[model samples]
Target: MLYRDGLTREGIVVDVIIVGAGPVGLSLALGLARAGKSVVVLEKDPGLHTTSRAPIIWPRTQEILADLGVMDRFESASIILKQFTMWNADSNHKLISLPISELKDQTHFPQILILPQHKTEALLYEALKAYPSVQVHFAHEVTGLSQDSESVRVRYATNGTSESEMVASYVVGCDGAHSAIRAALGLELDGITYPLMAALADVKLPYNDPNWVFPRLSVKDVPVVAVQIELGEWRLILPFTQDESITMDERVRLSVKNLFHQADYSLIWQSEFKLHQRISPQFALGRVALAGDAAHLNSPVGGQGMNSGIQDGALLCTALVKAIDTRNPALLQPNAEMRHAKINFGVNQFTNILTRVVMLSKGRYMPWVLRILNLVLKIPSLRQKFLMKLTMLGD
Candidate 1:
């Protein structure tokens, strides 16, 4: 039932038209469809995202996924991380340890899960298929968007070949950083991109620790970070200097060699990235609203990028369902304001501080800083507070 050249005369109309089928978009569709609302998810890409991007799902996000009825599937496909250890790579000593397992009394899913973004999307897509009222169209690129006093009319291309149109009562942009819906609405994403660039690669390492996740930083010669994603696969992040002389593979190899003193690992995936700390001025504009990366983008230090977006989807859908039922679009304003506040005060601020600490960890004062940090974390109440902030359960 895919629409090719424009919609039929008696064409299809839905309660909500969601642009982008990423985790945020898909999560929102699942919530809206389950609430008995007709939903249509439009994705420009032909299939699921395969990259190992955004691998950590915090406890708060796990709670939301549980409400979506897909936690069991995630539990089977992912690995739970009970503890996070930050090491002084130069000295080869542990700087601080955050025990995530101790939070069991505060939450049902007490630990963070290391599941790749692609698998998480697959589970959500499968769950979405059970709803007859929900329709997902792939290779459909949104080209134009306009809204009248009542509904929104979206113009798109099917596989970049033909044009089509679909109208809906509301439209949401869950697209990534370069969101078409956000651009079409003439809104600006304001923030600064850090001068530093990060090189990320997934590799099979010789280290075989299972329950603990390592954040090895402050190596002697190289400034980089490494974290274990699964059993044998690890993700490494280093500053990308854009030196045209050295190949990306060489940079990754050198970083790994410098940190681990071993050259026996195999590369799985690699990419260079520039970090940005930005957020849109407003989350809602008339009948069109933005969520996920479209609404905000922050440092990946705390693994809050995907988690915050999932939270956005869950909260926005609840407000949208009520607004649709009550015939009052103003009900969505509260959600927009609340999400904006959380991103600004909670995610952005926290991650910014973390990025700074990691960047400065190799400085002369880092040893003293680590000692003080270790002492603070030894306090049970303070450690629990830190855990709540990292897990997003504090909100």
Candidate 2:
């Protein structure tokens, strides 16, 4: 029962204090509350964002969401994507339509789900109502944190003015890349930011294709991704050069025209991003832990960042409860190790290579890569192995 206005803050310690009320944080809070742990969520924002930041929910993520018992709402509201087509702009032909059916045996959700990140956050917020043990405080920015063997102390502003204090048996930072908690812990982010910049736009257009997610790569230029978020609204993720100086709106308009061959479109919401593939040296630094972009970052090319963050929350939920219940802090170590290893050698590395590979459409070896991809799609065995990597079910 979270009211939008104000949260009741008694000076009492809770089981877990989660930073950031985005999907990852909220997902962790939900699982903790369902397990009967007292959970408090601290969010800097006033409410759920109006923009669509991350829109694609891969099959594995859908399975996690389904386990939370809220997939029906998302399935009813979003467009279920069955195919991903990579196009060869140089040859003016599609290289391959990815085989999602091959994942049918791996997961019950064998398809990708598309919905704005805000809507997903809202649903997670609403679902938290069923658990009375959870309290979500909006517009509360954490300023400082400290822990000593037993409980962690968190200091934050109630609404950006008055200072408030609370304590928790454990705390996890689900904040983004610029995490205050990560900074307070003095953890170093050990990775690199990619050279390419990306722009995402939510717009209304006459074009409609809900069955497929398309990314067109030019042997002479960078690639472009087009996805229909809903029946009338499309989310276009277009990359720009590092030195490009065009207005974001103009970029959105030009991308719509270039990709869909349609000039009549209205840009509603948009955001610009400098892509990065980075990971922290450690996820759990003592009683404080980092999740989501706070712990790791990957290219948006594979749509793995948010999905991985949600997976982090899901994995952390169980570990946190167990560690708190058993009074064994060492139980938390394995989760941090697993998260770091799976991403560093797995998603982070793969997406780092993928972000570079896509941008190198004009590179010398891109055509040969595309040729090999075509060959892979033709054979079921090879295609299934490829789909395992693409859908992340293999992880």
Candidate 3:
């Protein structure tokens, strides 16, 4: 159960075998490599995604990127998010606008940045090149995972036919939801999947409004959130209540036009999915740990899922580097415990409440909830506290 001077008894060169090469896994790989740890990334996809998913990067995460030394490059490609506004869809009345500029005194990076998830992943991957110890294997899907007291073993298939094996001191899963690593470890998500089917789309609008996030609350129909991912490219998330439309393309257009009153916009890409407010009871089960969607699934209402995953990756990297350097096997437990508490009670719970609130369109409690929210949001002290939580400045 020892490091054998860096490699395992079977001559495995990697210190950590990271399953999945999304932002979380890549960030962890980059962090470990920067600290002089040998790591490998195994991704099921042939390459990085082309579309924009999970677009908002919070202030706290921006600081983490600065620590990793990519903020300068990231800031160039990303747009600053100015404010988030809530509105009544039925009457088009503005309820509140929370300006992100209010956090100027709290941190150097005061506002959130809007950059697509794919670009973030690519940046993290690019940063790993400075360290020669990192290895990335794409189209290599991890099929089985086994661990002993000393080391963990991973088996993955390349091109879906050829199989190979590798051993490491520790293995981490950033494989995302429906993770093969998590399933091989026999862990349960333990939460609720929303009953309504949700649809998300990225499109080109006729006009430019890149600073605002419009959350349209509806009593007559499902709720919608429309925000610009780039200069003129907006992303929309709403309930999918499709009828007998001839084509999905037509349905997407009809839905957006009905809700946003936009007469002309080109749809770039669209997808339908289900949201789950779920989490694993433990972040790590022995030496094999989980991060990102593999460990937790947020509602996507407040864009917390990817942020939480990136935070998880940074913490895991720090913990494992220390553990490997000092040869302390117990360091991972405390790291996992701290992450569980921080995310379970913080991001996971915060987005869950937001998801439920946005869906309460025609409920009887709407009047009471709005009255209380109006009174509470009027307090500067409370709003500051909320901004702290929303941006996760403390994490």
Candidate 3 per-residue lDDT, tens place, 245-339, comes to 33456655654664466678889988888888888888887778899899988888778789989988998888899888876758889999998
Which parts of model 3 have CA positions greater than 4 angstroms off? 1-8, 86-95, 206-222, 240-251, 254-262, 362-375
Candidate 1: Cα lDDT at 306 = 93
What is candidate 2's lDDT per residue for 35-55, written digit by digit as tens?
878888999999877778888
Candidates ranked by lDDT: 1, 2, 3
Best candidate, TM-score-wise? 1
Which scores higher on TM-score, 2 or 3?
A: 2
Give one digit per residue, the lDDT tens place, for model 1 in 225-330: 6776767787887664444566777767776776666788989898888888999988988778899999999998788999999998898999899987876778
lDDT scores in order: 0.83, 0.79, 0.78
Reference-based TM-score, model 1: 0.91
Summed over model 3, clashes come to 0
Q: Which stretches of candidate 2 lie over 4 Å from their true place?
A: 1-12, 86-93, 206-223, 243-249, 363-372
Tell me the deviation in Å of residue 214 in model 2.
5.4
Q: Go through the candidates in order and give the clash count of each.
A: 0, 0, 0
| Cα error, candidate 1, residue 75 (Å) | 1.3
Clashing pairs in 2: none
**Pairs with backbone N, CA or C atoms under 3 Å apart (clashes), candidate 3:** none
